[model samples]
Target: MKQSEIKNLSLEDLRDKLAESQKQLTDMRMAHAITPLENPLQLRAARKVVARLLTAITEREQESLVENGK
Candidate 1:
């Protein structure tokens, strides 16, 4: 997913996507370990997506804390 698209998602939506992406990354790793993926690049892509999602979520949380003076 593009950063712009991710940026538009609500906090709850971002959380859901982050969870789904993490599961996909785990599944991809397990499958790859058992047998090489036809496209190993899929693993790399998934990892990057997970990282992006996590980063976005963290940024959002930090922003909220700052705004609330927490």
Candidate 2:
């Protein structure tokens, strides 16, 4: 997903997306181990997406912290 799209998501949405992506990544790995995926790049893409989602969530949390002076 694009950064713009990710940025538009709420914190709860981002967390849910991240959890779902991580589950998909795990399933992909298991499937790849049993029988090669038609496209291994799927795993890579999922990982990158997870990273992006986490980054957006973290940035938002930090912004809130700063705003609250915590």
What local distance difference test score does each model get? 0.95, 0.94
Residue-level lDDT tens digits of model 1 in 9-50:
999999999999999999999999999999999999999999
Off by over 4 Å in 2: none
Worst 10 residues of 1 by lDDT: 43-52
Instruction: Estimate, for each residue in 1-70, the C-alpha lDDT of model 2 and write its tens digit.
Output: 8898998899999999999989999999999999999999999999999999989999999999999995
Estimate TM-scores for all models. Answer: 0.95, 0.94
Q: Can you list the residue pairs that collide in candidate 2?
A: none
The window of 10 residues in a row where model 2 has the poorest summed lDDT is: 1-10
**Model 2 lDDT, full chain set:** 0.94
